[model samples]
Target: MAKISAFEDLEVWKEAVRIGVEIYRLADLSPLKHDYKSRDQIIGAAISISNNIAEGFEYNNNKVFIKYLHYAKGSAGEVRSQLAILVAAGRVNNEDYEKLKSDLSGLSSKIKSFINYLKAFNQKKK
Candidate 1:
């Protein structure tokens, strides 16, 4: 594998950024556009996913990176929950909801897998 010298080189961080962009686009649509609180919250959570990953990577320590990874994972979950709420309120359609959920789920899994990899790497170094 190529050495990842920046957070942007990480697949997980890329996915998080994609999700954030998609969420922002969705929020710009009709119903979601009017829902200020939910829109802000969902946007914040989506952004947090990428931000946490970047922040953690910048720390340059396995333990600190893992701690930020956990935060990123949690933010992914928060985005899913907020998306569900939007779906329930008719702010988002079923198809969009399903796609978003699937995307977030995949992102969450990627984060978890990376975390596990980091843990194993740390253990091996000990």
Candidate 2:
């Protein structure tokens, strides 16, 4: 297995980057773009997802890392909620909202799995 030396090398973090970019592009193309408040809030939540992961990993402690992972997962939920709001407002189409929602949910599941794995690893080290 390849060793991870930085947050950028993390698969979850990488996936978040891809999703963030996609959300930004779609948001820009949608009517939501004109609503700076919603657009910025959604984008900020997207960024927070991966950012929490990176920040937690830097602390180099499994317990602290797990806490940050929860934060990241929470952010994913926030983004999904924002997406739903946009869809309801007709600022974003159902198709785009569904796709992004799936992506965020998948990411949240991965974060949960990662947290579980980390907890197991920590137990082993104890």
Candidate 3:
């Protein structure tokens, strides 16, 4: 197995980065113009997911890292909710909305699992 040294090595972080890129592209294609609140919100949430992961990893403290991971997971949920709103508002197509929603859900699960794994490891160290 490959040794993982940073959050960048995390599969969840990588998926979040991908989701952020897709959100940016979707926002650019949105027909609601610049005044669309959902555009910025979606992008912000998507970016937050990956940003928190990186920030938490840099902290080097398990507790701080886990807190940030929770933030990231929350961000993923935010993104998922925003996507649902966009779909309901007819701002995004069903296919695109579903894709983003599924990806966000997966990211959320991965972050939660990783957090649990970290907690377990920390417990063993105590």
TM-score ranking from best candidate downward: 1, 2, 3
Writing each residue's lDDT as its tens digit, candidate 3 over 1-126 gives 365798788888899899899999889884734636877778888899999999998988989999999999999999888778878888888999898888888888888999999899899989
Please list the residue runs of candidate 1 whose C-alpha ends up more than 4 Å from where it truly belongs after superposition.
none
Candidate 2, which segments miss by more than 4 Å at Cα? Answer: none
Per-residue lDDT for 57-90 in model 2, tens only? Answer: 9998879989999999999999999999989999
Which should have the higher TM-score, number 1 or number 2?
A: 1
Q: Between candidates 1 and 3, name the one with more favorable lDDT.
A: 1
lDDT (Cα atoms) of all candidates against the true structure: 0.95, 0.91, 0.87
lDDT of 3: 0.87
Question: How does candidate 2 fare on TM-score?
Answer: 0.95
lDDT of 2 at 116: 92
> Candidate 3: deviation at residue 119, Å?
0.5
Using all chains and alpha carbons, the TM-scores for the candidates as numbered come to: 0.98, 0.95, 0.93
Error of 1 at 22 (Å): 0.2
Per-residue C-alpha lDDT of model 1 across residues 1-126, encoded as one tens digit per residue: 476899999999999999999999999998999989989999999999999999999999989999999999999999999899889999998899999999999999999999999999899989
Task: Name the candidate, 1 or 3, with the larger TM-score value.
Answer: 1
Per-residue lDDT, model 1, residue 29, is 94
